[model samples]
Target: MKSVKGHLRNRLVKARKKSAGQANIWLFYSFKLDADVPIIGDLEMLYWVSELETQPQVRRFTMEHEVEISLEELGDSFEEITVTRVEHIDGSIEFHQVASKQHDSFEKVSVPVRYKIENRIEKSHLVVIPAARLKAFSKSSLSFWLKVIAFVSQVRGYDLRYEMGQVGTSISICGDGTIETLLESLSITDPALAVGAVCRSVLQGNIIVDGLRSFGRNTRWRTP
Candidate 1:
């Protein structure tokens, strides 16, 4: 890849002891090389979130960093991870990262990530939902979204989306455009199938919401 400037196109140097590997920084949604992901620069956790972005995406990302380090001291074994920053429409900024199998390694890496918002240096705030608390959020909203997620999980997604224009139209008319309202308006004969359609709509990137928040019937949705 070349430009009129004749730069090395776009490259993220991964230094190695013997020989370095040259690869492109395609952290998926944030396509720009060297782009920051909230607090976590492009790393493994960012890639995990990228995978989830395909279905039920969250679009609250702000600019990422070149590199943001944690002050916590680890003896030597360091693992690369990413922390994500999301900016909501309500002027709230949230920091989150992927759940890691290496629990010890993940501890205190991005501890107290102090960030700025609206030109003010806010206090250090970090959020990583424990598995139980996160699951509890889902359990409360289990009536609808659980059904949708379950249906989507049990069946293969659409290989070819012919025409779902009505899904969008129905959402547009629903009050506040919430998924629950959308389902009600859809009037699909089989309610489970309607839930399946909602899941598909989300997977197709037609519907997006902040999955980090405690979401349920009242969760707001939008078209992209």
Candidate 2:
């Protein structure tokens, strides 16, 4: 497999060529827990780093793995991981990775995506939250949001699908109204941000992410 840096650099070069003459490039991304395929425990933290590219108006986002310990070596220190076959197709991102050399367990996670034009030009923000908190928030908030979307879609006669991505998660609805319409009518923030408050609370040391295994378990979410 190619190094993460090499793969990213190659993609970036091609992206630059496509969006030539664009003086500034803004990248917006986030770190999210993959609840569909939950990680082991509090001792290990695994997440995906998703990048949103602008100027080229690409629909697909590039994603890579971010873990608390190196997959090659198990330790508390952070390290880079090499993922195989990173590619964007249609409205989804697909990639595969082996968590660690010792584990040697290959896993693939894919999810549908919708690029927001507004986020592209904005500065990237780093979310400071513990891995446990992230897992808790992702599990709970995703479950609630998915349920809400499902219920709403059923009543409104629309088609709804829950998609988990490397770094983000979304509830896609198609029918009488679009996601934007639902958001506007419901006055709820983006489903991706449903856990923002909870995550921030964890970062502020006000909450601990324990006993959060119930979120998203009830629904039949698509897995990579």
Candidate 3:
């Protein structure tokens, strides 16, 4: 009976190998985010936390490599996050994040956030850039930024310089005006509005106001 059982097991293993072709395969899964919510860099951390909630029962696994997901924001809201796992011969696994799908969503209107940079040293201009875009920029070299000159010219006075240590491209006001000067000249009382306006100018390549205000605050060279 034992000899028969061993023969059957051997046959089953051989069958599996022949039919499957490969001895083992990497595992992967699809992850999706709700369409109504905005896609933010920090949201990835939320997903990581949610996965942790399934601990113990799910069994903890050691990751062989760090995960990275693409951060290209679509005009519409349907965004898909893909997680990939690679199995290695040494019993190690690698995980990666991928942005694979997108669709339109009418439930939510994306808005620029007024984020305060704690201990911000550069007093010239407030830099606001999507974290994912910043990561892409970091991976690139100086050649990647050459085209930015024409796009930045649309903003008027600011020069787009690449900072190797920084997360995103920053326009350090070539002129003298600071945030306070900008608010005063534009007759803008609210700081949030000012931040939004500045953020829009940096992102959209142009500001809505007319004359000097039309070019936005970046062009304003203050009186020393």
C-alpha RMSD for every candidate = 13.9, 18.0, 22.0
Q: Once superposed on the true structure, which residue ranges of model 1 sit more than 4 Å away at CA?
A: 1-149, 155-165, 174-176
| Model 2 lDDT per residue over 54-142, tens place | 11122332334431222222233233333222333333333333222232222322322122223332111112123443354455544
lDDT of 1 by residue, 46-164 (tens): 33243323323344553332223222233322222234555444565555544423233323222444443455445333444333433443444334443444455543443323224
Candidate-wise lDDT, in order: 0.44, 0.28, 0.28
Ranking by TM-score: 1, 3, 2
Each prediction's total of clashing residue pairs, residues at least 3 apart in sequence or on different chains, is 4, 0, 1
Predicted structure 1: lDDT:
0.44
The C-alpha stretches of model 2 lying farther than 4 A from their native spots are 1-59, 63-80, 83-130, 148-224
Candidate 2 lands at a TM-score of 0.19
Q: Indicate which candidate wins on lDDT.
A: 1
Scored against the true structure, residue 174 in model 2 reaches a CA lDDT of 19
lDDT for each residue of candidate 3 in 21-77, tens digit (9 for 90 to 100):
332332222111111222223323222222221111222332222222212222322
Identify the candidate with maximal TM-score: 1
Residue 146, candidate 2: C-alpha displacement in angstroms: 2.4
Worst 10 residues of 1 by lDDT: 4-13
